[model samples]
Structures are given as structure tokens and as C-alpha cells.
Target: MAHEELNRQVRQDLRVTDRTSHRRLREQGSTSREDLDAVLRAGFVCHLGVIVDNAPMVVPTVYGVDFVSRTLYLHGSVASRSLVRAPESTVCVTVTHIDGLVLARSVFEHGVNYRSAMVYGVPRLLTHRTDRRGLLTGLRVLTEHCAPGQWEYARRPSAKELAATTVLALPLDEASVKLRSGPPDDGDGPDAQLGLWAGVLPLRTVWDDPEPDPALTAGVRVPPHVSGRGHRTAP
Candidate 1:
């Protein structure tokens, strides 16, 4: 399906509850589902926050989104069930992209230009015995999201590998999206008379040239999908 049609299928608005309500900087908060989708689509990495052993734990992981289903697929660990052990537990997944540094004349006004999204839900774990298709689909979505066309170019997971892997699906129904961009907000404030330079220092991440392994076979060549990513900005 076309990207536009997929987006049309997504819920139009985000569900705002007490947890998602912005108490500060309400102007930065967003209720549009498209804003949330944009934040998620702009990055492949996310931080999964959940309670482990009665203690709060936050783990960094890669994620992919299924806009049609409004699902977020996350990579998990089979060894550490902190993510999937408790079937009834809720989790929070957050994805953020830092666009630049907002430099203001005053220290107190210094800020960051970023886009962030936080999703809260009870994750549904996909396992071989339970939902094999979902497991593979989630993994494929994750792999492609990180590196387009790599899933088909690389070896797929075997039955044994699939059994040892863990993947979670979380609904994007309840999420909070926030975006901060442009120049410093103190431009018209009292600090304007300070005569100090104030502007935004933009940041960008790009993919470098593909590095081949020392042990790579002599006949092997870098695929177009891999080599073409060189110098391209990352999502």
C-alpha cells in the first residue's frame, strides 16, 4: 500500500490521559496521531521502560511501526525476560530525535530542538509456539526499518533462532508527541540586550561507507542497498 493510504488508516488523534497530559510546556505537546507517527518514523531506536523485579528499568532497543495496525514492534531479549516475562505488565516505549541545540543568551534559556514520542500499553509477546507469524513479521519490520532491503539481503532467522528470540507488539493508541524546533525562545526576552550570539546549532546523523569484514570472501561485493546508503542521512 502507498504510504499515504497507510497513514490514512491510522487513528486520527492520540488518546490523552493523565499520564500523557503535558503539565509543562503544553505548547510543545501534540495530540495529532500524525505527529506521533512522524516521531516514530523518523528514528529506529527507542527506549523501552518497564518494571523489572519490582525495580524500574529502561532499556534501549530498536523499533518499527505498523501504521495500518497502529502497532509498534520492539526488539526484546529472550534471556532477559524483563520485557516479556509478565504478560499482564504495562510498558512505556519512547523514541526521540535530536535535531539541534538551541543556544540562548541566557543559560536558563538553553534548550534542545527535538521530536519525541512516548507510547504506553501492555505489550503482547510473540513466541514461536503462540504466534510465529507475528514474531517473524515483527522482526522483519524491525530489520527493514533499520536498514531498508536488508531483511531480504541477509539470512533470515531459523526455527532455532526464532525460538531464542523475543519480540513484543505494543499498541500506539495512547501516546504523547512533542516537538521543539526553530531558534531560541529568548530572542525577545530581556536577555536580548546581552549582545551574545544566539542561534541553533543543527545536528544530523548520516550513514558512512559500508565497511567489509576482514574475513569476507574475495568474491563478495557490497550490495547496492548497502553501498548506496553511504553519506545518506539516517531516519
Candidate 2:
């Protein structure tokens, strides 16, 4: 299907369902596929939560979201037991961006301004023993997602290095986005007259000057894509 058609279909399909998850905070939750896309695309890294052994684990890793295929691609060492087992069962992938600190009048009212999404699905492993081309493509996309200009700038991975890597794809069919923003909720409460200050302290991430490796060549200039982003907002 065309990208536009897929988006429309996904959105329509999402709306017809009850759209409730296990989250207790229903008011902050959203079933919009667009919101899931936005949250995933806006961030490159995610937390992969799965049950390894008898215990739960949340592994932080870089990821790429392909809207065309509606899959979330994850990469890690092939030797990792967690990576090996991720494709065998259902897992939850999450991406979150902290926008600010919500400082309320009462300690109990303190909270955070954040945009987050959680995806639940079983993953498909792509390796040299499986689909090699898909593995490379997923790795390239993952690199580009995390470091935009570095994929093309660096040399391609060798066969030996490729053997050491593993790629996993999880469909985005089951996902939800939850976001909380703006100021404190206690401004209109009885505590409003406490005379204490209470409001949101906004936070943001920005790209700073790039530092060259000390062992690098002396005359090489920083690339435009790497250098020009100083002070620019980050996803």
C-alpha cells in the first residue's frame, strides 16, 4: 500500500477499537497512530522490556521506526542472550522524551512533562543465518536514525563485524502514546494562596560543538551536518 493509504488505514483501524491498555492513567493515554509515529520518529533510542530468565529486564538501545513497513528495528550484539531471546516472545518497546519538570505547590502534586510511547509485539530476528540483506538494511537505518549523517560518512560493516551483530523487527500494530505537558495542577487549589512559587521548569536538549578525536588527522574540517547543528534543538 502507498504510505498515505497505510497511514489512513492504520488510523481508521485504531479508532474502531476500545483502545485501552493496562495503564492506570487513561486520560493521558492516546490511541492515535499518528501520535505513536510522532513519538517514535522524534526519538532514536528506546527501552526494550522483556522477560529474560525469571526476571524482567529493560535494556536501553537505539532503534529505527519504519513507517512504510510499520516495524520498529532494534540492534545489538549477537552474543547477547537478551537479544537472542527477544524474537522468541512478546516484548514491550518504549520511547520517552522529558520536556520539563512539573513543580507543583504540594509535594504530592509533583510530576514531569513528558511524551512517551509503548509498543507490544513479538520480534523477528534478522541475522546472517537468516536474512542478511534485511539485517544490513536495518542496521543502516538504525545508525541513520541515531546519528543522521554518520551512516554514509563511515565505511560499510565488514562480513566479520556483520556476523557479530543482530537485528530484530517488531511490528507497530500494538502501541500507545502518553504525553503530559504544561504547568502545575495546583495553581487553582487551596494551596494557591500558600505564597510559594509553583510552575513548570521547561527542559530541552540541544546539540553542542563537536569535539574531534585527539588522535584524528589535524587538517580535516568538521562536516557541515556535524558542525552546523550547534545550539539546535534535539528530538
Candidate 3:
């Protein structure tokens, strides 16, 4: 999407009702749909929050977004009570990645710096066939974001399978993004003289070699995307 469109979407989505002292929290935040989309695209897993039986339930699931439609799609088993109850309730979806572990001279100053995005919205059930198709496309985009070739090589969902799944679409509004990076903020004092190993140990997500199904034909070769899988530093 265009940068201007992303800025507009962020303005519409982020509602700032409070203030804080941290410069990172106050200034380095964004609500842009593009920013959210980038965050979503960088990772496939998201934590979904909803109320079930008057209690809060947070579940982890895969998510995808449609930039043109401004819709986010989530799917799970039709028999999942959480999925059934979530559509009617307010939901918060969060995606985060830990970039590194910050080791400081002082134990109190140690922290894990990371990037994260949170989305708050009400979900609607995807009932129309056309809408469902769009959602499925979004799903494909999500699953194959890193490995572009997998969407075509993998088995596609059938009509019967689609019918047995529950997919929800939530508008990309009322969200926030916060990120922190770099070394610990240990002041120049006694702790600085401790001479401890203080720096960052980077973290990364790597894809392992793809193992084919044992019952499959022996001559099949792994798809390019799958065979060439590599590690990427999360956000």
C-alpha cells in the first residue's frame, strides 16, 4: 500500500487516550495500517484475546490481512468454543517478536528488547462465499509470506474443509504498535564499573529441513521455498 494510505489508516486506527514519559512509548509508536501490516507480515502467529463465559481467554492462532479490504482473517476448528464465542465480543490481537536479550552490568537493568503490535476490534463472521475466498487468499498470504512457493505446492483447502472451519474477519482499526531495541539503559554510575559482559544476544527464527510424509511417493522433490529455508531475525 501507498505510504499516505498507511498514514491515514493509522490515524483512523490509533486512538491515544493517555500519555507517558518514555520517549519510546510516546514518540516511536505508529498506528499505520502499513506498519501493522508489516508487523503482521513479519510473523504468522498472533495472540487473540476474547471473553468467554464472562472470563478472559487469550488464544494463539495464525492470522492474515487483506490490505485492499482492510480486513484481518482468523480461522480455527468450527467446534472450537473460543472461535464460536469470539465473534460477538471485543477482541485484542497481538503480535510480537523478541529481537535480542539485553545484558546489563546491573541485574536490575537487564531486559529483553522487542517489537510488538496490538490490535483491538470486534470480529465478524465470514459467511459470504466471496468474502470467504478473500479470507482464504489472505490466509495463503500469511502462510507463505516467507516462503512464497508453498501456497501453490501445498494442498489447498477443499469446500468441505472450509465448511468445517470458522473464519472471522476483523476491521483494522483501533490498534497500537510499540517497539524497543538496542542496549540496556544503565546509567553511568557504580554499575558501569562492574565490568560485566553487557551487550545483546540476538535471537532468530529458523526453518528446519522439510520432512516429507512417509507414505508419499519417493521421487518427489522438495519445493524451492521449502528446500532453501533459512533463518531470519524476528522484527
* Cα lDDT computed for each candidate against the true fold: 0.88, 0.81, 0.69
Which one is best on TM-score?
1
Each candidate structure's TM-score, on Cα atoms with residue i matched to residue i, is: 0.92, 0.88, 0.80
The 10 consecutive residues of candidate 3 with the worst lDDT sum are 16-25
Which 10 residues in a row give candidate 2 its minimum summed lDDT?
Answer: 13-22
| Per-candidate alpha-carbon RMSD to the true structure | 3.9, 3.6, 4.3
Sort by lDDT, best first. 1, 2, 3
- Report, for all candidates in order, the number of backbone clashes: 0, 0, 1
TM-score of 2: 0.88
Tens digit of per-residue lDDT, candidate 3, span 171-224 = 876677877788778857688777777889988877766779898897988777
Which candidate model has the greater TM-score, 1 or 2?
A: 1
lDDT of 2 by residue, 6-103 (tens): 87876655432334373576778777777778888788888888787768888888899777888789875421466575546778888999999999
Q: How are the candidates ranked when ordered by TM-score, highest leading?
A: 1, 2, 3
Residues 94-202, candidate 1, lDDT per residue (tens digit)? 8999999999998999999999999998888888888999999999999988888999999999999999888899988788989998999898988999899999999
